[model samples]
Target: MMSILKADLLKVKRKWFWLLVFLGPFGVIALQLVNYGVRYDYLMQQEPDVWAGLLDNINMFVAPALLLGMTILASQIAAIEHQQSSWKQLLSLPVQRGYVFLSKLAVAAIMIFISSTLLFIGTVFFGIGLHFGLDIPFLAVIKNSYYPFFAGIPILCLQVWLSVVMQNQAFPLAAGVFGAVFSMTAAFAAPDWIPWKWPLLVGEHDPIWYAVAGMITGSVILIAGLMDFVRREVLT
Candidate 1:
C-alpha cells in the first residue's frame, strides 16, 4: 500500500500536475485581490462586517477556484494510469484494487485540500495587506474556507471515478469545468435543495447542518464510486 502511494506520488511529480495544483490557487487569489481592489473604494466607505466580508470574498474567489482545482487534480491522477499505460501494471500488483483506488483518492483529496488552504491563506494575507481591517471574524473565515474542502470530497471521488471509467483526459477536464460552472450557477439560481449549493456557496447563512449533509452525500458517493471501480474489469 505504501508502495502504491509512493508510485502515485511519483506519477503526480510531473510538471503539469504541480502547475495546476499551485497556479490554480494562485490565480484564484490574484483574481480575488483584483476584485477586492475594484471594490476597495466602496468597501472603505462602509463599515466592515466580518461575516458579510467573508461571504463576499468566498463568492468572488474561493469556490470557483476550488472546484476547478479539484477537477484537475482528480482527472490527472486517473490520467497518469492511462497515459503511462500503468493501469494494468498497478492492478497486477498484490494489493487490493480497493486499496489502489483509495490511495489515489486520498492523494487527490489531499492535493485539493492543500490548494484550498493556500488560497485561504493568500486571501487572509491579501485582506490584511490591503488594510481591509481586522473586522473580519477569523473564526468565520477559517470555518467557511475549510468547510468546502471537506464538502468537496464526494465531488473529488466522483471525478476520480469518472476519470478512471472514461480513461480519457478531455472528458474529466470538461466535467471539472462543467461542474465548477454549474455549481456556481445553481447555487445562485436557487440555493435550496441543490446538491452543489452547500460546497460552492460559503457564508454565515451556510448552516453547519448543510455542510454536515454535504459531507454525508460526498462520502456516500465516494464509497459507491470505489465499489464500482473495484468491480470493474480492466482489459489492459
Candidate 2:
C-alpha cells in the first residue's frame, strides 16, 4: 500500500500535473476578474451589502470553478495511469485491486481538496484587493464553501471510476461538462430530483436541505463506485 501510494504521488508530481495545478488557480482568478469587470458598474450602483456581494461572487463563479477543477483533476488521475500503462504494470504486482484503487482515489481527492481550497483563498484575496481594499470576515465564505467541497467528493469518485474504466479521456471530460451544465439546469427546472444540484450549486441563502441531501447522495455514489472499481476487471 505504501509503495502504491508512493507511485501515485510520483505520478502527481510530474510536470504536467504541476502545470495544471498552477494554471487552475490562475484560471479562477481570471474568471473572478472578468466577473468583477462585467458587473462592476452595476455592483457599484446598487452598492449591495458586502455579504450579499460576497455570496454572489461565490455562487456565480467560485463554485463552478471548483467543480470543474475537481473534474479535471479526477479525470487526470485515472487517465494518466491508463496513458502510461501503469495500470497494467500495477495489476501485475501481488496487491489487492481494492488497495490500488483506494490509493489512487485518496491521492486524487486530497489533491483536488487542496487545490480547491487554494483557489478559494486566492479568489477571496483578489476580491479584497480589488473591492474592499482590505481582508474582511471570511467566515461566511468558508462556512458556505464546505457544502460544495464535500458534496463534490462523490462526483469526483465517480469520475475517477469513469476515467479508469472508459479508457477515453474525451468521454469523461464531455460528461463532466454536461454535468456542470445540467447542474444549473436542474437548479431551476426540476430542483427536486436532480442529484447534480447538491455538488454543483453553492452559496445558497438557505442550503441546509440541499446540503443534507448532498451528503446522502454523495455517500451512496462513492460507495457504489468503490465497489465497482474493486470488482471490475483490469485488462492491461
Candidate 3:
C-alpha cells in the first residue's frame, strides 16, 4: 500500500494536480469578494454581526465548490491510467487490487482535503482584509470549512469508483456533475439518506453523527468499489 501510494504521488508530481487543489477554494473566495465588494454594507446589515455575515457568505459557496473539485480531481487522477491504458499494467503487478484502489482513493481525498484547507485560508485572509476585526470566529471557520470535507468523503469515494470503473472518462466526470447538482438541490430539500447531500447535511443537527456516518459510508463504498474492481477483468 505504501509503495502504491508512493508511486501515485510520483505519477502526479508533474501533473497540474496543485492547480486543481487551489482552484475550488480560490474560486469560492473570488465569488465572495465580488459579493461582499458590491454589498459590503448591505451584507453587514443582514447579519448585524459582521464576522458572522462574512463566515456565512464563505460557507454558502464552500460545499458546491468542494463537490466540483472532487469531480475534477477524481477524473484527473483516474485519467492518468485511463488515457494510457495503464490499468492493465497496474493490475498485472504483484500488488493486490485493494491497495491500488485504496491508494488512488486516498490521493483523491487528499487533494480535496488540501483544497478545503485552502478554503479556510482564503476565508480568513479576506475576512481580515475586509476589516471584520481580529476577533474572528475561528471555531466556526474550522467547523463550517472542514465539516463539508468530512461529509464529502462519500462523494469522493463515489467519484473515484466511477472514474476507475468506467472506461470513458466523460461518464465518471458527468456523474460527478450530476451528483453535485443533486447535492445542491438536496441542500434545500432532502432527507439525510440521500448520500448526495451529506456535505450540506453536516452540522444541521449533530455534527459528530454526520462525521461518523460519512466515515462509515465512505469506507463501505470504497471497499465495495475495490471488490468490484477485483472481480472485473481489465481489458488491454
Candidate 4:
C-alpha cells in the first residue's frame, strides 16, 4: 500500500494539481483582501469583535473554494490513471483492488489536507496583515478552517468514486460544482442531510453535532464507494 501510494504521489509531482492546492485557500483569502482593501475600516466597524468580522469574511469563500478544490483534486488524481492508460496495468498487479482505491483515497486526502493547512496559514497571514491584533482567536481559526474537512469526507469519496467510475472528468467535476452551489443553500435549508453544507456548518450554533453526523455519514459513503470499486471490473 505504501509503495502504491508513493508511486501515485510521484506521478503528479510536476502537475498543476499542486498549484490548485495553494490556489484554493489563497483564492478565498484573496477575496478578503479586496473586501478589506477597499473598505478595511468599514468592515472592521461592523462587528465589535474584530476576529468575528474577519472570520466571517474568510468563511464566506471557504466552502466554495473547498468544493472546487476537491473537484479538481479528484479529477486530477483519476486523470493520472486515465491519461496514462495505467488502470489495467495497476489492476493486473497481485495486490487487491482495495489497495488501489485506498491509495487514491489517501493521496486525495493528503493533498486536500495540505491545501487546508496552507489555507489556515494563509488566513492567519491575511488576518495579521489587516492588523486584527496579536490576541488571535487560535481555536476559532483552526476550527473554522479545518472542521469542514471532516465534513467533506463524503464529498471526497463521492468525487473520487465518480472520477473512477466515469473516465471523463466532466461528470465528477460537474457533480462537484453542483454540490458547491447546492451547499450555499443546503447549509441553511438541510445541513444534516446534505454533505456539501457540512463545511460551512462549522460556524453554526453547536456545530459539533453536525460535524459528528458528517463523519458518520461520510464513512458510510466512503465504504460504499470502496466496495463498489472492489467489484468494479471496468475501469473508466
Candidate 5:
C-alpha cells in the first residue's frame, strides 16, 4: 500500500494537481482581499468583532470551493488512469484492488487537508494584516478553517467514487459542479441527511456532530464504492 501510494504521489508530482490545491485556499483569500479592500472602512465600522466577521465571510465561500476542488481533484486523478489506460496495468500487480482505491482516496484527502491548513494560516495572517487585533479567537478560526474539511469527508469519498467508476469524466464533473451549486443554498433548503449540507453543518446542529457524521457517512460510501470497484470488470 505504501509503495502504491508513493507511485501515485509521483505520478501527480509536477502536475496541475498541486496547483489546484494551492489555488483552492488562495482563491478564497484573494476574494476576501478584494472584499475588504473595497469597503475596509465600512466593514471595520459595521462589525464590532472584525475577526469574526472576516471568518464568517471567508466561511461563506469555503463550502463551494471545497466541493468544486474535490470534484476536480478526483476527476483529474481518475483521468490519469483513464487517459493512459493504466487501470488494468496497475491492477494486474500483486496489490489488492482495495489498496489502489484507498490510495487514490488518500491522495485527494491529503490535498484537501493541506488546503484547509493553508486557509487557517492565510486567515490568521490576513486577519492580522487587516488589524483585526492581536487577540485572535484561535478556537473560532480553527473551527472556521478546519471544521468544514472534516465535515466534507463524505463529499471527498463520493466524488472520488464517482470519478473512479465512470469512464466518462463529464458525468462526474457535472455532478461535482451541481454539488457545488447546491451547497450554497443547502443551509437554507437542504435537509440534514443531504451530504452537501454536512460541510456547512446545515440545520444548525452541533458543529462537531457534522464532522462526526461526515466520517461515518464517508466510511459507508467509501466501502460501498470499493466493493463495487473491485467487483466491476474493467473492459477498457
Candidate 6:
C-alpha cells in the first residue's frame, strides 16, 4: 500500500499537483484579502466582532471551494489512469484492488488535508494582517478553516468514488459543481441530512454533529464504492 501510494505521488510530482493544493487555500485567502482590502474601514466599523466577521466572510466560500477542489482532484487522479490506459496494468499487480482504490482515496484526502492546513495558517496570518485583533481567536480560526473540510468528507468520498468508477470524468466533475452550488443554497432550504450542507453547517449551533455525520456517511459510501470497484472487470 505504501509503495502504491508512493508511486501515485511520483506519478503527479511533475504535474504541479502540490501547486493546485496550495492554490485552494491561497485562493480563499486571496479573495478575503480583496474583500477586506476594498472595504477595510467600512467592514471593521460595521462588524461588532472583527475576528468573527472575518471568519464569517471566509466561511462563505470555503465549502464551495473545497467541493470544487475535491472534485477536480479526484477527477484528475482518475483521469491519469484513464488517459494512460493504466487501470488494467494497475489492477494486474500483486496488490489487492481495494488497496489501489484506497491509495487513490488517500492521495485525494491528503491533498485536501494539506490544503486545509494551509487554510488554517493563512487565515491566522490574514486575520492578523488585517489588524482584527492582537488577541486572536485561535479556536474560531481553527473551526472556520477545518470544520468545513471535516464536514466535507462525504463530498470528497463521493467525488472520488464517482471519478474512479466512471471512465468519463465529466460526470464526477458535474456532480462536484452541482454540489458546490447546492452548498450555497443549502442554508436556506436544504435539509439537515444533505451532505452538501454539512460544510456550511460550521455556523450552526451544533456544527460538530454535522462533521461527525459526514464522516460516518462517508465511510459507508467508501465501503460501498470499494466493493463495486473490487468486483468490476478491468477491460482497459
1 against 3, candidate with superior lDDT: 3
| TM-score ranking, best first | 5, 6, 4, 3, 1, 2
Candidate number with the higher lDDT (1 or 2): 1
Q: What range of 10 consecutive residues in model 5 has the weakest lDDT sum?
A: 198-207
lDDT of 2 by residue, 1-236 (tens): 88888888887886476566657667867776787778877765675575457555655554455556667877888877777877777777899887887787788777766766776687578767776746555766665555566666667777777777777789888888787776665556655546566654543535655557666776787678778877767744
Q: Candidate 4, residues 1-236: lDDT per residue as tens digits?
A: 99989988998888888888888888888888898999987887799998878887787678877877888888889888998888988999998898898888888889889988987888788888878788888888887788777778788888988887788888899889998887777756763656787888643556666567767987888899989999889684
Show the colliding residue pairs in model 2.
none
Question: For candidate 3, what is the total of clashing residue pairs?
Answer: 0
Best by lDDT: 5
lDDT of each: 0.73, 0.68, 0.82, 0.82, 0.90, 0.88
Determine which window of 10 residues in candidate 1 has minimal summed lDDT.
201-210
Q: What does each candidate score in C-alpha RMSD?
A: 2.4, 2.7, 1.6, 1.6, 1.2, 1.4
Which candidate would rank higher by TM-score, 2 or 6?
6
Identify the runs in model 5 with alpha carbons over 4 angstroms from their true place. Answer: none
Best-to-worst ranking by lDDT? 5, 6, 4, 3, 1, 2
| lDDT of each residue in 1-236, candidate 6, tens digit only | 99999999988788877888999999999999999889988998888999889988898889889999999999998889999988999999999999999999999999999899999999998888977668998988887778888889988888989999888888899989999988888888787878899898643558888878888999999999899999999836
* Candidate with better TM-score, 1 vs 5: 5
Lowest-scoring 10 consecutive residues by lDDT in candidate 6? 201-210
For candidate 6, what is the lDDT? 0.88
Q: What number of clashing residue pairs does each candidate have, in the order they appear?
A: 0, 0, 0, 0, 0, 0
**Which runs of model 6 end up more than 4 angstroms from their true locations?**
202-205
